[model samples]
Target chain A: MNKLSRVLGVVRNQLATYVPRINATTQAAVAPTADPKVPAPAKDKHEGLMEFFDVKENWTTNEVRVGRSWRKEELRIKSNQDLHKLWYVLLKERNMLLTMQHEMNEKWEPFQSPERIDKVHESMVNLEEVVRERNRAYYLLETGETGERPGRVETNKVGMHYFFKASEHVVPPEHNNHWFKKFGCNRREVAKFRLYYNEKIWLGRLKEKNRNTRHVMKLYKRFPDLDEEALQAEYPDVNLERVKRWNGAQGHFMPRNL
Target chain B: MSTRWYPIYQRGNPQLRVFLPNFWMKLVRPEHKQPENIVRFITPTQMSDHDIKQYLEKIYKVEVASVKSKIKEGLIKRQRFRGYIIKEPDYREAMITLPPGQTFKFPDISTEKEKRDDDEIKKFQDAASQSFDKFKEMNKDRPGVPGWFSV
Candidate 1:
């Protein structure tokens, strides 16, 4: 209790010292308005709906210089409340930039610094990623789950597999007759399609392997003195000895001593 | 984020709250003349009239009397050579009415820019004319000669 009272006393003394400073700052702000010789502040007192547009000075300029987007590392250090506020600030900036671009397009004028939109978009993406990372960490610590939307790889009627994102529903899958009727695909035709699709995929892989092997042989033929280790590293899947033995791998010059 | 996937709402569940709503609202010029107090905005299709009202009131601090919105169909055009049809994405437009005494005017942002461009064009034209005059003076003695024949 003694320590608590002492801490409270220190906070009270600090507040007493800070109160006059805050008052002085407010007084300084008001002093400018009282002086007739001094020019009014550059920023308007209230922007209202005009906040949708860029500053008046920028309207006529062909370039509006701006810094790069917020990095994920920078956003990670900020607290959740700061991130929340920054999200709105970025949102408002994106909206303003879009508005300016749209209006400029309508007026047949060039929108300056179009990359600003991309920068803001990149910042928003990084910010969201950081938020998601924190959320995932929190959920994992609390519930052993990522707390992200659930999805699964499911084969469609066309035998094409896709990630199906699951959403909340009033009824379970067994009770949802309509969903089952739409998504259920056990027909013989689908089975045949899947078979053909698998064959095509396998053929594609085979063709790609053959192409790589041929390319390696051509490289060997062109540059017999090429570093074997580099070639092997480039095409790890190709059998270097088998490719070296192929006729295509031979050059017009005499074979070098092994 | 505005494009983040959300779970479907079911009755008797806790109210869903968007702590960091990222929906964007662009103030657009009205297609037709509107009342002084009416402002037009293009927002995401997912936003309803109530959402538009609350967005302006809460985020922009604008007092909205009412809001009416409609989904505008995008234009469909065919490729010039290939003739493949392309349809632009549809957008939602909201017409917000401010309080009776309040009004907003969409300022003309291009006038100053147009004037500056005109000055630049004039300068370019003057420079081009002066250069042509100089070239003519240089080639006065050799009429009908090609410009490439010059040293």
Candidate 2:
């Protein structure tokens, strides 16, 4: 049964490799709503459309007071298409608020309720997560790997040791001179940076050794029956026998080693 | 559109088209006033002058004459007893020149803002002063007892 399951898993993974990612077609299909007659999109897509576009409620009133942001869980069930459309709506709303805010600032008037933008941002993030959740679910069903960008640790020029996620470069790594100059970590970098880097590494090691030596001496004074081999094993660089004879390591009575 | 991770496109590969770019640009009140067309913006710092131009022209359908941008560092202050300095987030401010015809007016946020802040502060003071009055009332008959331990 185990062997059969293993073979089935391999077959699924192999098949996933062959299937094309939904990139081009997905982009084309989800293009702008050309059909002006197509009755307003479902509620999620048009959630903020009616109210936010214009100050329809109180056109004369300069400020539009609003409530709090939408919670994440409330939006988690929404579809991808709705989330996509909603993103544009939010983008437009933000721009409108900005325009309103700019005019207020110029007139030396106080900009009302700046937190409205924050609430909209909060809603957009929740909406994005909802879409991502569905994408993850679909990807898990179709492919073993997450359909999102694959990330891994990579060394860069600074040699400070940072994690860099490899990304899709338009040119291949070798041919891409700009990428090589900026991002790529070559043998020359490893050689140049490694010398000081190794020195820094050894300095850290020395500090650890000294700290362990002091700790072991303190341990010897309190617990006379402390296992010497295990102590040495725990800190390979620390000498257990010498730590026992230190003045601070002496207990109230005669020395345990003597 | 000009984020670090996305590819730097050349002429060919079906062009990385943005049906609706999700970048948000807010027109903030500039600390100092200049021309009427030069509108200030609070935007992501990575956005370039070109990005802002495309953003207004493509998304808002507004015509832009020109754009210039700069990053402003927020205030840095040390908190009491925290032993660490906290700096407010850095923000990008853009000055975009709109076409000759268009004029924008920013709405006043502080009409209700002042009232809300004043009321909140007043409530806090009332709560504090009321608690003090209650303490005095409870202690009126117990003059001999010490203030700290009597309660």
Candidate 3:
């Protein structure tokens, strides 16, 4: 509680220092904070409505500069509403970058520093996680349970069992035969797979064994005084002491004085 | 991570909606001649036929009569030094038939007729301005040399 208050205080101080210096012209455009009892100042209804893939701005510029993601600590101090606004901002940035990247590919022009798009994406994902954390906290405070996402387990299309996470659906499982058939899998194919899968595993093991043997041979071939203790620790499966006494671990070019 | 997984539904469910769907669909021109209502897409390999239906219906606001997807094997080549065969990942192409009346044609982005003329004009103007700037900067240092001489 004390830490939360301290963080909140720091954020309050930063808000006082920064918000006042913001351009006065821009201040009037943003809606002012009202009573908590009254619902959030009705946001522009068009705000979050599928603006990401809008086809308006196609050909504009070559290079784009973007800022770093908001850090966890920085986001933790923010109110839920501000965080939501920031999410939209990041979302818009991502959409713009993606559109530009798609256009660049279509134009066959080299996308300059494509990692900028990825960075924006990463930032958006992090911001989402931070918001989810705060939402969970708020729900816990209000309703006494973490409103974190839920998950479940189910079989795959191949009869292979896997976790099918719990999520809401447009149609209930009882009614949705399409979904039920979708979840079911081919069991005979899975059996045929298991046989080949074991063979592949055995082949991998054999290759791994050869690799280890060759590695040990190469190690001792180079070094006359290979540390046995260290070698044992490194290759616990191989009998290092026995391998050292064997002729395979010996150098061919020169006789060791030791 | 999957698009096909439809979960169990209950009353007053929060609309099992995805806030930010990571699915990407590229609107590509069809190769062969097709009906005006049909559109083609080179979508992600992981995208199912159902996903294509949902993407068009929900995002594009286009009614899809049917969606058929096929995986086209990528080009294969012999590696330069290793002498080993390398095959690229198979990309899925979805051919979706729109209900009716809707026609999508790839816009001609580059105006080919004016391109060469515009380039030639721009080049000549740039050359002229550069020469003018050089002429202006030339007469600053030399005593008797012409204005075009070394500055």
Chain A TM-score values, per prediction: 0.66, 0.52, 0.55
- State fnat for each of the candidate structures: 0.59, 0.26, 0.06
Best-matching candidate per DockQ: 1
Error of 3 at A53 (Å): 9.6
Per-candidate TM-scores read 0.71, 0.54, 0.48
Which tens-of-lDDT digit does each residue in A90-131 have in candidate 3?
544454455545645666665555776666567666667776
lDDT of each: 0.78, 0.62, 0.60
DockQ of each: 0.32, 0.17, 0.09
Whose DockQ is higher: candidate 1's or candidate 3's? 1
Those runs of model 2 whose alpha carbons end farther than 4 Å from true positions after fitting are A1-72, A88-122, A136-147, A155-162, A168-196, A222-248, A254-258, B1-5, B19-22, B30-38, B48-50, B53-93, B97-101, B108-151
How would you encode candidate 3's per-residue C-alpha lDDT over B1-151 as one tens digit per residue?
A: 1123445667777667654455666656578998766667766798899887886666434678899999888879999998999998677889987656545554433333235447778999999999978776765565467654443
Best-matching candidate per lDDT: 1
Docking class of 3: incorrect
Better of 1 and 2 by TM-score: 1
- Give candidate 3 misplaced runs (Cα > 4 Å): A1-66, A100-116, A136-207, A214-218, A250-258, B1-7, B11-151
> Which parts of model 1 are misplaced by more than 4 Å?
A1-47, A207-258, B1-5, B78-86, B118-151
